[model samples]
Target: MMATPAQPDNGNADVRAVERQQVDSPFFVQTLSRELSASPRRIAVAIVLAFTLVRLVWAYALGFGIDESYTIGQSRFLALSYFDHPPLHYWIAHAASVLFGTGWAIRIPTVLMFSATSWSIFCLTERLFGGVAAVFSVLFLNLSLFFLVSAGAWIVPDGPLMFFLACGAQVMVRIIFPSPGEKEPTIIWWILAGGLFGLAGLAKYSALFTLAGLVFFVIATRHRRQLLTAGPYVACFVGLIAIMPVLIWNVQHDWASLRFQTGRGSPQFAPSAFARMVLGQIVWLGPWIAIPLVQSALHAFRKGRTERELFCVALAVPAIGYTTLQALWSGAGFPHWPMPGWLFVFPLLGARLSGRIRPAIHYAITISLLTLTLLVTAVALGGSGALHRLNVPALHDPTEDLIDWSPVAKVLTPLRVGRPDGPAVAGLDWAEAGKLDFAVGEIAPVLVLGRDKRGFATRSDPRLAGRRGLVIVASEEAWAKKGSGLSCLPEDPLPVARVPVGRAGQAELTLLVIPVEGCIGAAQ
Candidate 1:
């Protein structure tokens, strides 16, 4: 045994030592910090491009979500505004649809918008803190799930809202905190800020919270004197003017959108709902990241000495506060609703995190990358129908939503139910209508049969009156629940086809195509 004990493997020992040095040593951190500082802009751009590439792949992998389907389907008409949100994102998606013919192409604008958002965050953070902080801020922004997937790649209003808000915040910061030599920010800067804020409003009504934050910042800080200047008033006026279209559209619709939005907030309080909402946010933002973000926000409010710290806190509080209240009161508040407000907290978080030890940063990055990889993998598997093989229960399978409804389109396209001056296709629910509308595309006039028709109610044509057509029942249970509504037809609905819809090779649900005569306008 003594003779068998030979010399140690120096090569392996050396490699282990090198690994430890790279992972554990401060020298590695210093080198990284120097590199990041040397070319922060390039690193930021690289982060944006890398995330953009991942998002592009993701966009192609998954089918459109319910909101995305609704937005794109309704965007075909190109209105002044939409039932759910303002017209900006819809217009952007519409333009992309026109150029690229819908499908995944509609998500292009949102994807690119997030790129701009990343750049804006980088610039804004660098201006407030420093280059290293700015780079980390962009990295953190892209790493967060809500920002990475929802705002980054999805066809949603959040993308444009985040972009415009970030840019506006940057402009507002310049106005509030001028350089040492500069006496005051120019009027042009104020005007630009207002215009940017207005565009943010056009993106989503929630942008008002950020605008309020700006006002609060002006009043609470030494910048209160700036509020007296015409610069502030002119900015407000410009912002109001920019969002006039939303007002005009609302006025034309008898303030229906306003009423709908205002009415969404519940009058009663719900502790469980509020808890769920907060937890949902933590999950969406990632627990590790969200915890630090909360700490950063608290730190900024408690001990922040600089104008930048107060600025982020001011802009962030209103949105996060209001949405949290809405969740407590309504119980129906969504997770992503508070995201734009949290967008401001990133710089503070970046600055905070950048000061931590290298191992901590590495740990956070590893966790974030792992989470993203898992999410992307799940999406990819679901989109490719591989997950269906697992036989996960339909209700519990989150990936079920990613199932392609294009199969339904293939079945219905030949029928031409939406043809003008002829029959129409009907869905029992608004969500179903959206999916149906997207799938059928220009081939048919898709309408909602039941109440809660959303935008489809306005888009429904009188010409469809008394016309016979096919109704797509998403499941047997849905038909069982709503099939009686079609009883008014002269004859019973004939089962035209049974389209098996699911992922992979398993059938999770079946699409029932039933032909009904003389019931085109009956259910609505």
Candidate 2:
């Protein structure tokens, strides 16, 4: 007979199962504060909560910046896609407005996206390295000025793009390194990853860079054969399907979106342009974070411990290379265009710097402290009139593009109210059009009166073509010297109000009354 087998400890096993279940529950996250040193889960929750509170305060400290104003204008019109970017940012802001009614309330979605991004970073880093590395990654990311403000505080496409990109990246990591009992990354997970990538594309066209990164990883890894499998194809199909709304919109508009984006690509290379791109990256990422990100990427590529490590580095290349070459050919590019790639680098940095994170830990803390100091000080100084009291020269004017427009609105509102048919209001470009729309769009129809159409091109109403209107042009006196406002009107008009809007109060406002036959007749 076989030796008597020891009876299983059923009661102890049941107790352990209950503990595991409790730990895995989302409710357990907050309790980790009790064991903060040993639990990354609780640490992540605390960091995210703290970051959320800080961003909430920052959001209310100032009015919307120029880009925020533009996005707000777009939120008024719901479309499949807009002239500038995908519509998701506007859609989300629109939802926020419905719930909270504009003002700083619109920025709530951005704060939430930032939180999700932080959590995703934690999960991704944890999967690749360990819990400590995950915590470091969250701190590293939140400390970067670009990530802290532009990506977090502002209502821009990057926030949503980063959130989706992080989600997809985390999913990719899961697929690459399944848990102990899992045999393989299921087809369902691959489908889910593809869907996330698709949603990212819906957020911004730059998500193509992410797709390219994924493809590169698959090719470089031993999972190259997966392309022959249904998983890769399913992912591609899902992504394509997810972006269908954008495609449909473009199709309906004669592919205007595609043409517009394609035109932005550089036709040839220029070192100066490439240098500008590099400079932008350095400024955006901050020296401390940027240096380590690059070093980590290089190290991962040269001496990666496993296929997963190398694959992570591959995710960053397409965006970085594309932006760099685009800058070379175009002679200049936006600093934030390459940001999606940098998102991948953070997790890799956490993993690469596992044991060597001491130096960066201090740097992250210092930068966070200094940045908060400068932000609070700036707000305080402006509120105290110290900024205006400096009376700096025009070149050094801190308030050049940022002026309170209530005075101008005060003057224009009566004129608009006094008119019959609510005479249309106009501006020479999208910036003025958007600003005027925000200022007093409710008083009358607002139009962009120039060749650079933008969002207003589709909004131009034939009925308003012959209507009387006022055009407000806010710019430096130098712009006036160049006669920037004259090209939009058929006849000369007198100044209705010269209101101080920006630095030196050099902005101009003029009256233009179309003939009874209308502006359409005048233009012809």
Candidate 3:
């Protein structure tokens, strides 16, 4: 016989069973101190608070942006190859989804990865500088605008990439100049690092840039002697091997991804693009601290013969130089592309400034840090309306460095889900196209045709015309390069849907959905 709901605990058949987890699992209550620091106890409480609150703000307030859906979609596929980027972030995010569950889980791996990196930075800085600089440095990293906004909530190659890159940086510095009383870095340690690089490379092939950075940066400095060591060479080669699956995948696909990325770099490497990229980096670095960081970077190289200083400077120089070259060579680079460069430089800056930047540098750093935090709070809380209302030109103007996919995804998702029979080729927006490729892959595979890229369309070419299911995922500016019909649209959206996305009630996205789902099997 079944017991009623009013039965006592031991005798009640209706009592719900509760399982034990961590001491502070969601089921348990946590203290204020427990929710604000690095421990699992603090993290569990704080993560739920931050992630849920931020996600709600973004979910309702943010319209789907160009790359959002597609990045999510790519993570869904979890491959080592893609039309753009290697497959590391995608697969990890996918794996995280499987581990924790998707939607929010897509972001969990990145969150943990970034946090660990920050913690490692804290430890490294603590060792290099004093505890004060270390704490502030990690604090600055976690609270910084780019950290919270672009790189934080936004799941991309750079987040996981940054984590591993930062880890490598920690290991790298130790290998170059062992700190006083520091243990000798062993071969097993190098192997562990080699594995991290392999995993990091899967995030973005540009990790090769880091590999190149290490070789050149070391040669440029006192660690130049260590270059003769077999460990160093083995470490480098092993990293390449670790990520070799992606290379193999690329070769099988005729290196289409590499050509697509490298070929695109030329226009961005032009004079103007390079200048914009530099300016963007300065902004992300925070203007007040940016100058000093630059000073520290320059000083470490120019004013130093010491092994410690040389080792620190060595890591910073090459990756930044390579990134600059790529931007000048192409008209665009991912905004977060400079991340590993930042990771390398930060501790270098700390090491240089340890006894120096403190107290004196504290004022500028504090002002800069506070200003950034205020700006972030305003932006995060939907208070950017004040800037817009005041007609701050910066509030309304769009810089071309980054693309928005929020509105476009909003337009595509419901319409496609509602209809379940439409997909098409896009004329403009690889970010949007890539995002769309990711978002729609699970529900149905959409064939995004090449309207740009000078004719890169093996994925959806004429070889499969008679097959069913297809769609066009183009933006107006992109279509202008080729489609006269799309180019000539006189306002009102050229036969499509447009959705806008933004915070503070402003529209920021534009997804144009045209029915063509019949070409899916064809593309497949």
Q: Choose the strongest candidate by TM-score.
A: 1
> With candidate 2 superimposed using the best TM-score fit, by how many Å does residue 57's alpha carbon deviate from the native?
1.0
How far residue 440's Cα lies from its native spot in candidate 1, in Å, is: 1.0
Q: Which model scores highest in lDDT?
A: 1
Better of 1 and 3 by lDDT: 1
Return the TM-score for each candidate structure.
Answer: 0.90, 0.84, 0.71
How well is each residue in 443-501 modelled by candidate 1, as lDDT tens digits?
77777777678888667763464555445545565777776775455555666778887
Model 3 agreement with the true structure over 296-329: per-residue lDDT tens digits: 7777667435655555555566667777667777
**Residue-level lDDT for 301 in candidate 1:** 74
Q: Rate the local accuracy (lDDT) of all candidates.
A: 0.80, 0.72, 0.57
Clashes found in each candidate (C-alpha, N, C closer than 3 A):
3, 4, 48
In angstroms, the error of model 1 at 479 is: 2.1
Error of 1 at 211 (Å): 0.9
Model 1 scores a C-alpha lDDT of: 0.80
Q: Tell me the lDDT of model 3 at 96.
A: 67
Model 2 error, position 83 (Å): 0.8
